[model samples]
Target chain A: MSYRAKVPKPTVKRLSLYLRELEHRVEQKQPTISSRQLGDALGLTDAQVRKDLAYFGQFGHPGIGYDVTNLVDRLRKILGTDRTWNTALIGAGNLGRALMAYGGWQQRGFDIVAVFDQNPDLVGQWLENHRIRPMSDLAMLVKERDIRLAMIAVPADRAQEVADRLIAAGVRGILNFAPRRLDVHQAVSISSVDLALSLEQLAFQVSLGLLGSLDEDDD
Target chain B: MSYRAKVPKPTVKRLSLYLRELEHRVEQKQPTISSRQLGDALGLTDAQVRKDLAYFGQFGHPGIGYDVTNLVDRLRKILGTDRTWNTALIGAGNLGRALMAYGGWQQRGFDIVAVFDQNPDLVGQWLENHRIRPMSDLAMLVKERDIRLAMIAVPADRAQEVADRLIAAGVRGILNFAPRRLDVHQAVSISSVDLALSLEQLAFQVSLGLLGSLDEDDD
Candidate 1:
């Protein structure tokens, strides 16, 4: 499952979806699953599922389909979910706390090891299990804990500043919940979960009288 | 800009992006913008931008490009952000509170008119200005307030339950934050914002050393 060719971003995302589906099947004690079954569950076509999985390698037998356990392991390894990633959370506000409280991240191998905030009042407080650290401690904690990923949940005006700090602190990737576009160096990878964007999409469907027909799976 | 033809989902999402870019240009008091400039700012191509905008309707002259204000207004109308949409929030937990605190929704036309929770303790509490109501009152609020959209921020186990209630209460569109697949009838449009999916996408890039090169905008 090593990366030999450039996989399309969409294919990579579908791989994550397939992994989730496969995990569910494994939980049900299913021995193997065909591409058709997987597609039906996720509202995708079987050929599309096969095409996405092919980006990694030949997965399962042609007629018998994919062994649930083996495919799960392969997809997990390909997705890098096989190993735990230590992450840092910046901005201990409501959004940040909600993200921290989300249990899926831990289940999928992302651990929020450190929490940081600029407010003096929140700096000494404990959120969940982690003590809120000051902004000055970011670089040090990133180095000491070897945190390569960070989540930004700051205000729009402060998103770029926190991103700059995270980048300078040696974070390679960031998942931003802030509603502002962040300008970053080429080395830093950023993904934003824009709640407004999703709502606007829903609004478009509602306006067009297409709300009932459109199927969406992404949050 | 009425729905004459079915717009592709990807185009609809990009329309939102175009509106955001145009709003930024308007704030700067810029009078006009070409497709190339808009595309560059959002990591899209000039032709792609033109194609997306074309789905709604023609804008600007061929040689002069689009007027900033005209394009913004057209996009806003096409995306249904021209008027406010009344919304309801279910589940008054940390995530629900965080969503209530988010200012972008109201800024971009989605208004949270009512908040509901099943827990008796949270039922009487106030989140922001809206007094939290019990689940029993959802139907009444939906009808009285004309709330066409609902946001579900409950725990994963409770997400489906709340979604059913919202649908039963006559909510036409839903934005679910709970990290699980929701089964709903065809008449209800639902979109999920899976934080785990976004993190896994980032993880895939970090693992493959492609984090720096992959450019992603939502579909």
Candidate 2:
């Protein structure tokens, strides 16, 4: 289990990109792909691609390169995407509704089993198939669905409180979209999808004329 | 401008956090703050805070630390958020709609001047006062509004095509929400916000029971 600690964060991120590329290759009926080809497609070096893959296990075929389908499966298991994860979503606002309508997560094996909102008017509203429940129902649903992962799309002011509730309800992983930072216990895992931060980073790069020359990390 | 090349990517990201923290500090009427206080709030070390701030200039006083408002202004200028950036949003789907409705970007200096979707039915529809334009109007709008940045929230298959159109329309930077990797020109900068990828990363950590012990990078 400590193996994940050994894998660098950037490597973990690149693994997701590699998995996406391999899946694309599979769709194109590409039986195999060389490290150079794989790396080139993702704007990475062949050595980096090889090294990242080698971290998990030895899968290189010496001359022929890696089997695209096999690598896809292995990467899936390594990233823990091979199985379905029942996830809870906090907030029923515009962003939360959009996330519910977003089919990408379900396709990637993360299913939003329940949605919660503090607004009384939105409590019974139906987003996709799940009825938007109030905050009080969060604990019940988390336990009922065995939900360990949660997504927070609440406003910045309410995000921390929502996170605390999710953690109290036994959620171990959180993907936060709010712009505020949350203080969590050491036993929890949280990743943020900060839209403004991403835009700011892009703005910095464009402002300084630092374009694609650098080896950018694609998180 | 070349100083950005010397500033590590992580440092650049940290700068954004520093700005956010400083802005928060300003609102709280805190005139000055030590590097340790700022770093503690952000889960970084005082040494890291000092080093990152030192990269741009000597903002710290020998005893008084840094002036909160002054540091915020400097960080804003350094990150290029001091001025407003007129941006375009391609694809008015669910996720795209969410971004359009999200007000965080505007507060951070990114203004979505135009919204575009290739769908004929949605072409004349309005999203937050800006009518959805077809791809044909992209070039004109880019010139008219001085848009150098764009956000692509289109389907994975259409992401590259939208990016190409944006680049052709003179977009120098892109924040892509698509799961696919885009091939942009060397002079253009691109950042991706992959929701599924973030969930996958969280899943991996939760699966390994690697909760919060590791020094997680907050991107």
Candidate 3:
């Protein structure tokens, strides 16, 4: 069977998590998994897992669930992570640096080909054999090295301006770690990864005396 | 009406973003906003914005959409961000330093109180107005300074251990920027701010060729 490209965004976000769970299950040598089992691993309900998978055609068994390896491949192809993604990290700060050193990127087939920082002292430095070049090199790096994915970790004030530069540098996709919202062009896609908001959210939940909301995600 | 301690998690997250947007609108002296206008500003559909607001009861009018100032005040009261959140940064690395200097936290009602790092060099060091303290002082500062929220910007290898210390020090909620997942007890809430997974999700959306799938909310 051929793959389709009309998967929903929510389904795709959940799919990456599903693939991670499936990879873990596959490592355990589990040949097959029920939607319930996969759901348990990724915090999705059995019905949601089954329903989400059904969007890409029937990929699971009626009672047995899904084949772990097969489903991983399907999600991989659908997510476009099946191919290696040459990513570039902007702002070699702690979060970006931590990410640059993370093992999970390689696990998911993403290569941090290059990184750029605006600091004069930090620029021309080395991060595990990868050079931290100046922001001025973004355009050159994007065109020369085929860097399509850019991660912005600069200060909030510079977030929008840096995004504009990345867009001009030919970055089609951006993962902004900066807290400020960037006004990227319509052609560019940006997702702001805010750590504080997530914390405030959990705090708000804790403050609300609503622990049961999370508990409801039981598979 | 007394504050309810059980707003939905997704609702709280959206409310956080809505409050920020509404604050801007109110500051601009926009007397009213329609559900469609709010949706347009936040990149959500009119129906979604309305449905989310409806969960908190009747906030928007049938014709006027919603009074920007009234809705902002209401959302603020609901999300508990009407007051400031004093947050502590664990690990004074590039990410933590970057975040402390980031300005959006104040815009969204999050304030950084202190920073902790195990590194001898970083500890007892000063970054701007904030001083970096040793890990041994976490419990003291958290108790004395009333720091309830923590942002973990440590390396993946040390994230879990740092989390244990933070939880023991009376940290109620955590926004984890580290790549690895940390396990915590039910009493302590932890939200993973994974940058790579976020990008992969975006790639999945772009691959699907569905713009609707990537529609983001302030949450």
Candidate 4:
């Protein structure tokens, strides 16, 4: 139901940011927005905003600027967030439990329908609404639930092995929370969320008295 | 002592990646690496690598390239990861507990020395080495520990309030794990790690059959 375009990765990330801003405007009952206003709010130039949006398709009006509601719909579809996606979470540790209870995913059309862990003690225990299943059931549950996306919260040493298993079990996209760079097949997609790396960046900026004035659109 | 530089934010992020790759090479007893080799490992161009490194100082040799061990040390210093940073974690929930147990922080010179929560029942609870303290103790403990960095793992609704309190408590940098975008003064540095946004990006790429070929150096 979705199509791919040859958009730059940075542009793709900015699309999400624009969506957030547009959604906020929608909540405020705003009907139209100029690229300059949108870019100013996000610390980006109006030309940059126009070019990034142009990569997908034309959504801007000459004088009316962009129709806020129309652009929001197109962005949601382009980001593949318009439909619900069933996702799997591996690792029943604190990170996994926290992710299970995270309220943001359901609001964004992602539902973590299954949880898997290697520990025998954690297996069969219920976290939120789903039970913590063992690794052996990963393939079966993935197929049963039609899960194409998975999240890895395992430790550094176990992340690679768990990723291998997820790929073999038919999970196509992975959101890795472990502080490790995963090597996956070129056909699959992976995004890493390194918590400590984020803190380190903050430390570097703080040490230099950087204000982080511009909210960089990044993962 | 650590000093700040006017380095671009993207370069700052890539410096961390270079440090990781260099440290790995050091462990393997590799003496030196060319810009091409280092950039290849991190999915960056050789010129890009050289430019990023050049922002701090000259470290590359004509033929011998960059000294692995020395570059690692220099990058660690430049990124403010050479010395331990005392940090406080606000929120003793599942996310905070997982962050407490994360092994990557210590290796990278960040130590989460304090844990705080607003819930009275969770207060005084022991998580790892630190007991959960009430919010009333936040300012005093931050002063007593000389803590300038903090991690906000609180829920989205409470993130802004917690950030205000932390900034008032003399924290200079914040690594926010909450999904909300916080408004803070220009003096303090803040970085957000939105887990659901990472998932949404992955879903977008997966839906479009994008390979995620390039490991973009982003937060």
TM-score of each: 0.89, 0.81, 0.87, 0.92
TM value for model 2: 0.81
Residue lDDT tens for model 3, B1-219: 423443545565666667778888988999999988888887678887887788777467788779887787776676677788788888777677666766667766778889889999998889768888999988999999898788898888999899888888888778788888788866576677776788887666556654332536422
Which DockQ-derived CAPRI band holds candidate 1? acceptable
Best by TM-score: 4
Q: Relative to the true structure, how large is the alpha-carbon lDDT of every model?
A: 0.81, 0.82, 0.74, 0.83
The better-scoring model by TM-score among 1 and 2 is 1
Tens-digit lDDT track for model 4 on B117-169?
A: 99999998899888889999999999999898999999999999999999899
lDDT of 4 by residue, A176-204 (tens): 88888888867588888888878887888
Model 1, runs deviating above 4 Å:
A1-5, A28-36, A59-68, A212-219, B1-5, B26-37, B59-69, B212-215
The candidates' interface RMSDs, in order, read: 3.9, 3.5, 4.7, 3.6
Better of 3 and 4 by DockQ: 4
For residues A1-219, could you state the per-residue lDDT of candidate 1 as single tens digits?
Answer: 336246765566677778878898999999989989988887778887887788777566878999999988877776678899999999999988898888877878999999999999999899999999999999999999999899888888999999888998899888888887677866676778888888888888777665543433221
lDDT of 1: 0.81
lDDT of 2: 0.82
Give the interface-residue alpha carbon RMSD of model 3: 4.7
What is the fnat score of candidate 4? 0.58
Model 2 spans > 4 angstroms off: A2-15, A18-78, A120-125, A213-215, B2-5, B25-38, B45-73, B213-219
CAPRI grade of model 2: acceptable
